[model samples]
Structure formats: structure tokens, C-alpha cells
Target: MEPFKVHILGCGSAVPTNHHRPSSQVVEVRGKFFMVDCGEGTQLNLRNCRVSFSKLQAVFISHMHGDHCFGLLGMISTFGLTGRTTPLHVYAPADYATLFERQMDYFCKRRDFEVVFHPVDTTRHMVIFEDRSLRVESIPLEHRLPCCGYLFREQPSLPHIRRDMIDFYHIPICYINNIKNGAGWETPEGEKVPHERLVTPAAPPRSYAYCSDTRYIPTLHELLKDVSTLYHESTYTSHEADKAALYYHSTGEQAAQVAKAANVGKLLLGHYSARYHEENQLLKEAKSIFPNVYLTDEGMVFDV
Candidate 1:
């Protein structure tokens, strides 16, 4: 199994505090890195985590909020200064295209690479990016601004070859890939060998979902159904449920409810409001609803 992990870079909410930074995280799938919501101090946090800056494949911005995208310009500038030649793709709302272009033109004039912008429709749930190992889709979220969550799903690999079967059938190395792909083989005497005898079933595919700055929208359960891990914003406790609803944010209890409804394997609660000097209350609230919930902290890594 290739490395599949989520690194919590910064888990604070809009207001920065001495104890916490703003929203940021890195999702690593099969050695490829994808940044989600690059808030202020994200680059520094990335360095703190020892993630190679050059390995970042793409950046996904949930919305145009400053807390979610303020670090983007600085990161881009730094990448240029570091002599990065690989083009970086940024996915965000279409409204940000003009602003991003202007900022890049003025601040990153001597760049060695191109910054490609992909407009995302926050209202729709659709596949926005795909690679050999995984695909990322946009999950429509209800928030004060135009925002959408991200669902990262790993692609199923070919089945593992059975060494004993290979030796028993005297299968040629050239036919291993075909056998892994479910093709059978025939011996010199025309003895048919079924694919099931040559290879074992592939491991089940895994998926992770990142939902932030959103209200308690029930539709989310459907979007995140059976996800291996779910990172959802828990900006407040149930005591402030009314306030959370007013601000289009979810409380810790609500986050746990969603996780339970979706049947996710694990729930990671983040985007904490600065008011909670300690996260114990939030964790307790969430745990009361879903025992598998975990409070996301900076520098914490979760394998999915």
C-alpha cells in the first residue's frame, strides 16, 4: 500500500490566535501532495512538517475567504524564488480568476513556472481533478460564501499476483500484468487457467473527505458515505449551536452527527474557534455523538 495520509498544517478558524493558525492541510495520496485551504502561515507549517515544497501537485481552495487563501500568493512567490519549474495548478471559484491573475502579474513577474487556474463551480458536485492514483471531486457545501468540500478517492490498483500459481502454471513474466488485470492463461498443452487461480483480489479503495466552514447540511451524509476518513469543521460546541448556524458553521456535535450518518471510518474535527482555549469540550461533545471522532491539531498526521 502506498502512503496515504493527511497532515494538519493549521486548524484554527478565521481569527488567528497565539495558540493556533488558520485553515490549512496537506493530503498525500500515493506520494503525491495536494494542499487544501492554504491559510496564513501555511508555508511555514509545511516546512515544519518537513514536506518538500516542490512535491505539491495542486492547491484546492474551498472559497475566496482570506483565512482559506491568504497564504497562496506568498507560497507561489516562494516557489518561484526556489526555482520551481513545474507548473502549479490552483482550483478555486471562477470569481477569483481575475484577482489571481492580477496578483501574479504584479507580484510574480520573474516566475520560472506557470500558475494555471481551474474555475470550480461550488454549486455542483463533480470531479474536478483526476490522476493515475486518485480523483478529487467537489462536494457542494452550504456556507456564508460560495464554498465546496473536497472528496479524494484512491483508484483501485491491479490485483496482486499469486506466486504459487505462477510457479505451478509456469506462467511467463510477460503475462503477469495481464493476469493481474484478470486475464487467464493457457499452458503448452492447452490447459486453461482461470484468472482467479493466478491472482488475488485487490485491496479495497479508500477515500477521504474534507469539509470546512459549512452549515449542518444533511446532504453531506450522502456525499461522504463510507469515506475512510472525514475532516469536518467543528468551529464551536453545541452550546453555541445557534451562533454556528447563524455563521454557517458547524458545531462539534453536528460534525459528529454527520460522521455517524455517513458511516465514515474516522472523523477528524478541525477549524476550531479561538474562544476554546482547550479542545477538550469540543472533543467530548463530538465523542458523545460519535466515538471515532478526533480533534485535529497542527502537525498531526492521520493515515487513511
Candidate 2:
């Protein structure tokens, strides 16, 4: 399976550090891109990662926090400067729509392309966007302000062709596609060749969930049952549990607990505080609970 690819642009918390910028990432699948969180310096990172703005179909903001969406206006202006004619969709909480439009009026006076805003409720778990191959859903979160994450799910592929079965039945080449689509073929003798004998079942559908800037919610795993990969914010370590709760953030351990509860294939940790020069302690703590966990850094790409 060609899984969804996530390119990490920035992973730092509210405060940017020498090693990290802010919270931002680009998700790609089947050559199409979707951005999650447009923090400061996201455009530069996009260029640095070789992910062209033309491939981005939409942007989903987790919240109105500066670290999460400060780069939206700047990116929009840059898109205009680069002569983008395709309409760009931006999804965020309903309250942020007015402020976003106001900012666009002041900063982006005239642009050829349309910048469409889609207001998300930030309180419901429902499908917000979908295409023939993929769908994105909202995951409500607990934060100081209204926020929601996104789940990208790929559609199941067609069954694989079986050369041996085709040869045995003397099937015509024109009928291969139909067989893969779960159709039954009749031989010259009028014997039925079932799809089960003509093709193998397809791989299970894959999914990736992006959750950041929220406190630990034990019930969140229920919404993430079939997700194979989870990019969760580990803003602090267990030692800073008090601070994490005060700021409505989760410790590394809490993130891992959520992953374990969901039974996900892998857990990706990011969104670190500025104070932590290294996240070794955070990685180790999460590993104690969920073994298949890794840290995501700027410019790194993960497929799941």
C-alpha cells in the first residue's frame, strides 16, 4: 500500500527555538497535498521540503493559536505572488473566519485566485472533505480555545489480479479489470469463475490522524479505532505534568497511552516545548508505553 506521507515542517510549541520553528506539517497521498497547521515559516519549509504549493489542495487549521496559524496570511500572499490561479480552501473554527477575512483584506488586497474559507464546528466528529480516493474527518479536542484535529483515510483499492486463475480459465485481457472489480466471468463451457478465484482481496484501508494542542483525552481513542498512524503532540515530559495540564497540553506518556488504547500501528511525537533542546526523555517515556513510537522533526517525511 502507498500510505499517506506526512512531511513535518515545524514541531516546536508556542515559542520557537533555535532547533525548531512552530507546529506545521504537509500530508501527501497519490501526489496530492493537504496542509495541517500553517505556523510561522511554513512556506519556507514547504519549499525546503520540495513540496510545491500547487500540489496543496487545502489547509486545515487545528486552532486559532499563533503557533498553529500565524503563517496563513503570509502563505496566501506568497501564493498570489507566485501566480496561483487555483482556488485554495482553508478550514478553521467558525470564529476565526471573520478575523481571517479581515486579515486578507488588509494583507492580500488583490489576488487572482479565490481563497475560500470553510468554518468547522470544532465540536462535532464528522466528515468535512472527501474525494474518490480519500476522506478527511474532524476530531474534537480539549484546548484553551476551540480546536479540532483531522483524520485522513484512504479508500480501499481494487483486488489484485491472479495470473494463474486467468490462465486456467483462458480469460480475455479485456475482462481482467472487471474481474478485479469483483465481477464473475463465465467460461465458454458456461462455468462460472468467481472473483475469489480471479483476484485476491485488497489491502485494508489506511488512515492517519493529526492531533495537537489538546489535553489528554482518554475517550479520544474511541474515535481513532482504525487509524494506523497517529501524529500526537507531546509538548512536555511526565515531570512537567502539572504545566502540561495548566496549558492544556499532553505529556509524552499521555500521547503514548492514547496510541496504545487505539491500537494504532505507529505513534509519531512532535510539538515540543522550546526549553527541551532534545526530546530523548520524551521519546523514552512514550516508548515505555507504546513501543512503535518515533519523534518527528522538521523536513522529515513519514509514511503510514
List the candidates' TM-scores in order: 0.98, 0.97
lDDT of 1 by residue, 102-205 (tens): 99899987888888999999999999999889999999999988999999999999999999999998888998988888899999999998999888888899
Predictions in order: lDDT: 0.93, 0.92
Cα displacement (angstroms), candidate 1, residue 101, comes to 0.9
Q: Any runs in candidate 2 off by more than 4 Å, and if so which?
A: none
| RMSD of candidates 1 onward, in order | 0.8, 1.3
Clashing pairs in 1: none
Local distance difference test, candidate 1: 0.93
Residue by residue across 1-304, what tens digits does model 2's lDDT show? Answer: 6647999999999987899988999988777899999999889999999988777889999999999999989999999999899999999999998988899999997998998999999999999999988899999999999999999999888999999888988889998888887899998898987779888888888899999989999899999985989999999999999999999999999999999999999999999999899999999999999999999999899987
* Model 1 segments more than 4 A misplaced: none
Best by TM-score: 1
Clashes of each: 0, 0
